[model samples]
Target: MPDVRYVTQGTRAAIRRTTREDGAEFVRLARESAAFHRPWLTLPTTERAYLHYIGQLEREDREGFLVCVRETGDIAGFININNIVRGAFQCGSIGYGAFPPAAGQGYMSEGLGLVLRHAFGPLGLHRVEVNIQPGNKVSIGLVKRHGFRLEGFSPDFLYIEGAWRDHERWAMTSDMLDQRTGAG
Candidate 1:
């Protein structure tokens, strides 16, 4: 059994397990960022939708979710390492969104690094992928900073903001992770 621990940056921000206690805060951030995220995110039904989303996170397979917090304990973002696959592939994809207030603060970047390490190391995953909207320069830069390579582009890859949009595929393998540490 693997454990999900809190990740932090000095005393500024933290990432930890999502809990029922976070329901209200999560809902607030999700709603507040609806406009900013509507272009890339799937629409939710209601305020309680996060409860259902949290339920999915408890599964032993398929998905995992985390909550990002500011030093003041405000929930600022959400991240997930989902669609996990094992055996021959040993892969998964990352998805995330930050509240309008939290964007550009490097909170997601720090959280991503911590989670990706666990995904490849303790989880024994070989590859992780990120599908970023071509127009989302912030996300593209984040993935690239983490050593993910641009694999290709898929037109109409995701249906977002009412129509299908192109997404650039980026991937990082365990070998690539190792290379970053001179262990490959």
Candidate 2:
């Protein structure tokens, strides 16, 4: 069982760490939202696969979170901080997926904002990067709305759905987040 930490509470949703108990609901949501995540993500839709996925996230370098509806506690989306690096370079790469019922509901936006806060605050991460495929306008827009700046582009940056895919690198530093929120 993974430790659960509440990141933030929003008007319609709350962001919190993913737990083993969420396996059934998470797999159901992933299966139902397959069309919405096809080219961009490959979420686990089966019980065994879901457990394996969560186990991987339990590793030291990765963190997983879920965005849930405040009123119902239903999962709306998920966010992951992967490849964390400490020491002088305190950073991580982020990936996310919004489920069908919550795809255009703005829950992801609220959840991502909370994730950023947690990442910069208790996590002590200095930077977070989101690598999006150029054609993924929705993903790009989400990061842009949160003030991520375009850092560069990578050819065949990652393997997705089989073939290597290109990606546009967008990043936000802790300093940038502080500047945006006027925290410091």
Q: Top TM-score: which candidate number?
A: 2
- lDDT tens string, model 2, 25-140? 89999898887887887889899999999998999999999988777777889999999999999999999999977888999999899899989998999999999999999999
| Clash totals for all candidate models | 0, 0
User: lDDT tens string, model 1, 67-158?
Assistant: 45545555557778778888899998888877768788877777777677777877889999999998888889988898999999999888
Cα lDDT listed for each candidate:
0.75, 0.90
Model 1 — which ten-residue stretch has the worst lDDT? 1-10
In angstroms, the error of model 2 at 177 is 0.7
Instruction: TM-score each candidate.
Output: 0.84, 0.94
Q: Model 2, poorest ten-residue lDDT window?
A: 1-10
Shift of residue 102 alpha carbon in model 1, Å: 1.8
How well does model 1 score by local distance difference test? 0.75
